[model samples]
Structures are given as C-alpha cells and as structure tokens.
Target: MSTSAPASLTGRTVLVANPSADLYGSDRMMLEAVRGLLKQNSRVIATCSRTGPLVDRLQELGVTVHITEVPVIRKSMLSPRGMLNLARIVMSTFPRMRRLIGAARADIVIANTLTLPFWTLAARSCRRPIIVYVHEAESSLSRAARTLLTAPLGLADGVVFNSETSRIACKAQALERRGKVRVVLNGVQGPATSRPPRDHIEGPARLLFVGRLSPRKGPDLIIDAAALLRSMGIAVTVDLVGDVFPGYEWYEDQLRARVRELHLEGVVRFRGFQSPVWEAIDGADMMIVPSRGDESFGNVVIESLLSARPVIVADHTGLREAASGFESAVRVAPDDPKAVADAVRRVLEDWGHFRAVAMVEAVVAQARLGTDRFHEGFGRAVEELDR
Candidate 1:
C-alpha cells in the first residue's frame, strides 16, 4: 500500500534547501521537488548557497525563488578552517534565515543536506518541522564526516533518502524519532522532444563518464580501460565529464598523470562538466560508471538509460540494483581496468540486444517513474511531516 499523509499541508509554507547549489544534480533535484510542491499550492521559500544551474532554470520556470545563503563547509566547520567557514555560515546564513522564516512563518523546513547548521537551527527555534533529504551515503563516508553530519539527523523531524541504499545507510548512521526514512529515487525525464542530431560519434566509438575527478568515481581505472581498448584495436573514445571538487587537486592530478603514463590521451578526453550531459551521451556508443564506492543511486545511470545509452558499471551497491536488466547494463569489477575493458566490449558488441532491453527500462522511467510520480510520493512525505 502507498503511504499518504494523515494531515493536510495545502496552505502550509516550507523552507526548501539547496546547501551547496554547485550547478550539479543535487540542486536540479531540489528545484524539481520545489516546483512540484508549488503546484500543490504549498508556499516554498528556497534557502540555498544562492548560485547553480537550477537558479536560472527555476526563474525561467516562473517560480518565486528567494535565496538565503547556506554555506557548504566541506571540511569540518569546527576546525580552524571549519570554524572560519562556520563563522561565515553563521554570519551570512543565520540572520537572513531568521528574517525569512520570521517573516514567512514557515510550517516546514526541507533540508537538502546536513551541512547547513544555520537554516535548521532557525527552523528548530521557530518550532517548524524539518525534513532532511539525505542524498549522500553517510555510512560510505570517512569517520570524521559522519561525526560532523550526525547533528542534522538528530535535528530532522523526518528524513528522505535519494535511493534505497542511502536510506539503509541513513538508518545505520543515525536514528530518526519524529518520522521514519523514505526512499525517493531521483527523477529522470528526457527532453520534451529530441534535439537536433550531431555528428560527434561518426569516427570512433564514443563513451562517456559523468561526475567528478576523484577516487570515489574511479576515473583512472576508466582511462586504463580505454588504453586496454586501444591495445585491443577497438575504435573507442572516452569523454570524462566533470571537474574536481574543492581542494581535490591531488586526485585530479592522479587521473591526468595516468592518462599520460598509459598514453590514452587521445582515446580518453576530460570534457570538464557539460551543462546538458545528454549532448555528450547522444553522441556516445556507450557509458561507463567506474564508481570505487557504491553509488547511492546514480542519476547519470538512469539518465543514460533514459537516453537509450547502454552502460558498463562497476559492481557497486546502487549500480547492482539499477542494472537489473543485465542486457542494458553489465557489471565490471570496481577499479579493475581490464575487467571494465572486457565488459565494455561485450556491451557494445551485443548492442542490438542491450538496446532493446534498455529501451524497455527507459519506457518504465518515462512512463511510470516520471516527475509526477516523484511529486506524489515526495509531496506526501512532506505532508506526513506536517502531521
């Protein structure tokens, strides 16, 4: 049976969060949720870091977006560097949040992350119910990160996880008192109609790897796999699609260094972060998800599938579940370049079979698991918090 809220929240007000707002997938999901909430007649006042790809998208959609800065302190905000960041979060965040919530008299607070101490603190003072949306896997995190993050878990009246893996991880990380955790998978919607075709894939077989340049994403392994493909005389081209996150230069350097060492420079290209990743994928023969740690749920994975792009993914937590139809996505060993190389060849060669199964999965996504379904489920989750 589906869960619905016992109480109504049609006239209630909510303070939705976008903690980092780094023009990434996280902010995009938050914006989509907020728009749905607005459609249901709930007043949503956004409190975020004040910049992202979603900002313009939201404005273009004609939503009322009020930005109250919620600084995202990646390192411990209580450390000397963290304390300075904490001070900034407090100084800029607290006052604006206090004024906004004070003026709006919000009934609910939907926090996008555990990082924003000021927003939830103000929500607590106002006696408003706070629903925490945990997009990350706290259990997969280093010990130090969990220590800094537990505060938000304790503060939340309820919790929403981005995927089932994230929900289990959240439960293991901390206890929820007022409400239980719910798994709300990220929504994947293709363009209203297809865009004009491009000829980028006319040469070699194009492959795409979307996300940051780091160990967790396992990009070096991907480069190694491409080099292996070159050795095997496969006409393949790999495009990596993200920049290094704050202070992760050493990890980025490692990937660049590997590309040089392996001589996969021409075969594998770092495309930086593309705004609409579909453009990159459309021109691709395949996609690779080389995650070292388990992904909570890769939006890119679903997005790739929706684009009818077959994938070769590491055997990680979320990918295992998402790659249900082995036809569309095949499993590879995490951090094993040779294994990845072997799997990619299989997926591309058996393209006709995988493409058929992948399209069926895409039908499920575009039909059953559309944004409206996300709205009905997540809006009900928020309404439950109101009760």
Candidate 2:
C-alpha cells in the first residue's frame, strides 16, 4: 500500500486497457463501469480499442479517448509466422500505450481482463496501482503468458470477479494464496419497467442460446435436448444467437447438418451474431447457457431475469455454481440432453410458479442489475485497497 492515493478520482484520470474489441460480455461490463464512474465525475481514457460498441458508447459518455490497435494474433508464438506478428503487435502497442498513459496521467490503471496485464506492468513506472477484474477463468494459454498472469494477478491492489463462481474458479487457478477478491455481478440498465408484460405463447416455448456458436457453448447438447422433447411430443423451438469461434466454422456447419438430419427443420433457428441481444431476450421466454468451459459469469442470466424469464445453465466444473438459489435457474449435467430436456419439462410444466418466483426475484434484483451498482461495488473495492 502507498501513503498517497489519487484524490477522489473525480477529475483525476483512470486508464482502462482493453485487449480486444470483440463486443463480448466482459467488454460490455468494462464499458459500463467506465460510464458509471464518469457520472460521478471521473475521467476515463481507454487504450487499444478504436472500434467496438464500447468505444462508441464511451465517446457518447464524454470520456477522453485514445484509440490504437492492440492486434491479437490468435496463433502459436512458437510458429515462425506467429512470433514475427506478435512481436510487431507488442512493439506497436507498447508505444501507443506509453503515449496514452502519459497523456492520461491516470490516478489508477484498470486491467479489464488477464489479457492486459502488460498494461498493468506499464503502469508501474507511473506509480499507479492496478485493479484486475476477471470475468472469465483462465484458458490453456501459450506457455509464456500463463506465467505472466500469475504474478500480476497476485499483486493487483484490487481484484473483482463478476460472480462467486468466477471468483472461486479464479482463486482456484491463480489467487488462492494471494489476496481477497470481490464479487461484482454484471448490471443491466435500461427502460423495461414500463413495457408490456411477456406473453409466453402456448404453442411452443421459444428458447435462446446466447454465447459463442462453438462446441464449447454445447449447442450440440441443446439440439439433442430438442430431439428428446420431440420424441416426447412436447413442443419447443430454439434460436441460437452467437457466431462460431474462429476456425470452428466447420463444426457449426456440422451441427446444422445434424439438425437437418434429425428433421428439425422448423425446430431450431440459428440467428447469427445479433447485436444488442437484449431485444431478442425481450421476445423470447427462456435463455440457455450450455457452455462446457469455465464460465466466470454470464450476462444473459441477468438479461433473462430482467425480461422476467428464467434459464437452464449446464452444470460442470467451469460453470456450475450459477444454479445457486435464483429459483428461476436450473442446472443439469453439462452436455447431457437428457438432463436438459428434463429441466425444460420442469420449467414448462410449472411455468406459473416459476414466473411468480422470478417476478419477485426481478423486483429484488433491480438495484443490483444496474450500471450504478457495478460502479459502486468496483469503486468501493478500489477505495478499500487505497486505504
């Protein structure tokens, strides 16, 4: 701890480093935190993202912006080509960040994910302690980056995980002997309170799967679940709202063929890469998170609850803790269509009781699910670290 901290963080700047502009869940959370902090009179300067929905939103919020490219070359560093490209990105990004950090002269530096620990290390020269926020657990990394994340993650003055599941998983990987971690649930801020109530049409429930359209998202299991329901003569339709992960386009195509082979022409809809998926949630009745990977937290869970709906999340090592007491949520075996179909039957058969439970949960969650709540939670964590 230092004897001096930046005063109040009002006019004092805070630099947030974003690794990529993928328009994913954690990216959105990072943008919201910046916007909320600004409302309290903080100035935010984001680095290495010139494009994405977040950069546009930050400009609209009146924050100072420095845009540059931190190209993520998704390949092995050991490759003859990969090393050359990575070295270029690192060299290019280093100068841009040094310029951004110098111009911003930030009160604090915020690492939006483990991807930007280099930014945290850069902040050391400026004497700004870093706040590390983890939204997803570790991945099987290139040999070098994994070693780098451990030490910086341990020394970060503040660490915030989006869910208890994520916090525990992150601790299990990198923080068990390190320090305290905070759980800051992702928030939803919008004007839905005055809207018309959802009408779950009696024909077939419209289910949505809203993560990457890869095998990791377990779309295969959801399709199998649909097949199981068809076997029982129950009606259900699903719309998948994600794009295939890079290099997995063939797998996505294979799943489509499986749907066709099963004669599920009208049962499954692949709605690809929907922007502002909150609208899709508005139209649908239930959301499913079938990820087989370690999911740190999910924003779709909050969106479904905001729409006064519920979810069926897969239970597995990287993701199971989400089934804890949300009444509206049920956890079944990951990648098991039998368990998935059973959970769906439970929801459809008891929709009324489930809605009542979710309605009350919605009222209680209003405060926690807003942008302000996340800002307050994160701000408190940083201030505590300063003291």
Candidate 3:
C-alpha cells in the first residue's frame, strides 16, 4: 500500500469481515462503524460466519451480506479434535474467501475482530488495504493465544483499537512500534434525555447486569453479591439480562444451580438477552458490570451512564478506562462478591446524591462519546488507508 492520498471513499467499496454474527458488544460496535462508513457514501459488503439478527440488521442498512464459514479460533477450539475441525473449516473456506474478495472488488478490507486473522490473509491475497480493528484486551488472552493472534497482525496496513488499554496491549505483544495504530473509542447513540426518575428509594433496590452470561463477564459474581446483600438484611433484586454464549450452556446451568443453592430464587432473575438494552437499564436503579476478565472497552458502562444510572464495574484492564471519567461509577475488585456487595451498599446508602451525579455524568459521557466523534475517527481511519 502506498502512503499517499489516492481517492475519496464516496464511491469506494469496503468489505467488513466480522468473526461472529451474534449481536454482542463487539458486533454492535462493528454495526456502528459500518453505519458510519455508509454515512460517508461508501459502498459496503459485510461477511459473517453465520446468519443471525446482526446479519439481518446489516442488510436492512443497505449493505450487501455474505454468510461464509469463517471459523473463529478460540481457546476452547485448541484441543486435538477441535484443532482438526478448525483446520478443515479453514482449508475449505480460504479459497472461497479469496474469491469473494476478488469478486467484490473491494478497495478496503476491515477485519472487525482479533479472532479473524484468516480475513487478513485473504485480504492480502486480493491486494486490498487491510485494517484490523481489535476489540479484545491483552490481559484476557493466554500467552499462547496472544502469540497466535498477534502473528498475523503484521499483515495489517492499519490497526484500529477501541481503547488506549487495547492499543497498549497490542503494541506490547503483537504490533510493531511504528505500526499505524489509531485509538478510536467506541461510541453509542446517547439517550434523548435522562431516564425518568425513580419514585422512591426506600424499598428494594433494583440492580441490572446486561452482558453475556459467562465466567469472564462475572454474572455469577453478581448472584453471589445479591445473596450477600440479602444476608445482611438488605432487600435487593438482581436482574441478569443476557444469555450464555453457544457451547456455554453448562455455565448457565451452573449459575441456576448456584442460585437455587443460595435460596436466591426471588432476589435474582435471569431475563435473557434484551434488545435496546437501554430499556432494561432504565428499569433498574443501577447497573453492574462484574467482569472477571479483561474488557477492551465497556459499552454497557457508557450505556448505563447515558441512561443516568450509576454503575459498579470490576476494576480491570479497559474496564477501569471505561469507567474513568464518570463520578457515578464505582469500581470493585474483580471476582470479589463482598466488594461488589459493599459497592452496591455504598451507592444505595446515598441514593439521591448518586442519582444526581449519575445524571450529570450522563451529560459528560454524551459529549465524550457522541456519534459525530465516532464517525470522524472511523472515517479518518479508512481515509488513512488510501494515503
């Protein structure tokens, strides 16, 4: 790729490769980035391994969609049988992926996650400018996984990271110091106005957790915290509003069993995945993000702030960065149920003050993470490819 300005994106075609079709944090962020590209009058062709609501939603946005067998290499897929199956999928898909790139005649290729290094390989074959948008933090990856993931990053023309935390991690492990790296903080469509105020705070406090039900996300930690609060004579209701990932059904079963063991049937409720998650955030008095692993960026934390709800998040990796500027956010040690319960108690102890602070923080967060800023950063990253 030449480092001189070539052309504008007004008529340029872009191919976006996403690892999964499910609408989680990274998927939603990818959608937002695609929307930004469309606004620039660029033509887009998006690819995913499977069909889901995200694929349908992309089509609705006027982007051409390709459903391919782009198998993601995860830690779980490192076993002997798993590795064999992965190799078969990759071998079968590689040629087809290269053909798709050629057929699309894409001027730019954007691999939207670290898990899809194969997309980088295919894009290289097509001689298109490759930009890898990394959404995972380093602390989350094992040493072997880090090496495996970073190995192909040298092929990228430009790298987009969602946060400074992720940028530092990637540079330290995968990327060259001179690599073209851009830190584009993820943005959300801020709520029109602060959510309606709660009528009373003297009753049972409602807490919300809205992400995947996995060990990394620490949903079980929330349940344990709820039990602890109950034991201390505090009436609290915890609403878990996300489903377990595919192949993680056993984790959900474990969570349910733990809930039963703790006799917290009434205190904790599993309200599977909810769309327009703001509605769920609005219904709760506070939002909790008890992640036990590294998060590249916590979109849910900003969403809660935008909804004028106080947040209690695990103080780790990019999570600390996400909750940094908001006075309404309380940070607790990761995987510490007692710390979670204590933070919750502190927020509720002075509920009125915290509510007011949350409203103010919402205003600050909106200005920092507005759609215009996100679009500008995204546009600049793409435009850099032509230079």
Better candidate by TM-score, 1 or 2: 1
Pairs of colliding residues, candidate 2: 188-369, 294-318
User: What are the lDDT scores of the predictions, listed in order?
Assistant: 0.72, 0.70, 0.86
The TM-score obtained by model 2 is 0.85
Residue pairs with clashing backbones, model 1: 77-82
lDDT string for model 2 (1-387, tens) is 232323576576778878666667877788877865665466778765556566676677776556666654342443556656666667766766666677777778887876665676667756777787777665544445444444567667777777776665454344444445667777766444523235455888878888788776788888988999989888889888888866899988988999998888888998888767777776677778877766766676666666677788887643455445578878777767898888888988888777777777666656657666777766665555544
Give the lowest summed-lDDT range of ten residues in model 2.
190-199
Clashing pairs in 3: 3-387, 4-387
- Full-model lDDT, candidate 3: 0.86
For 149-218, candidate 1 gives per-residue lDDT tens digits of 6555676677777788777665534444434667777776575544322223346777789888888888
Runs in model 3 deviating more than 4 A are: 1-7, 78-85, 172-176, 192-194
Residue 240, model 3: lDDT of 96
TM-score of 1: 0.87
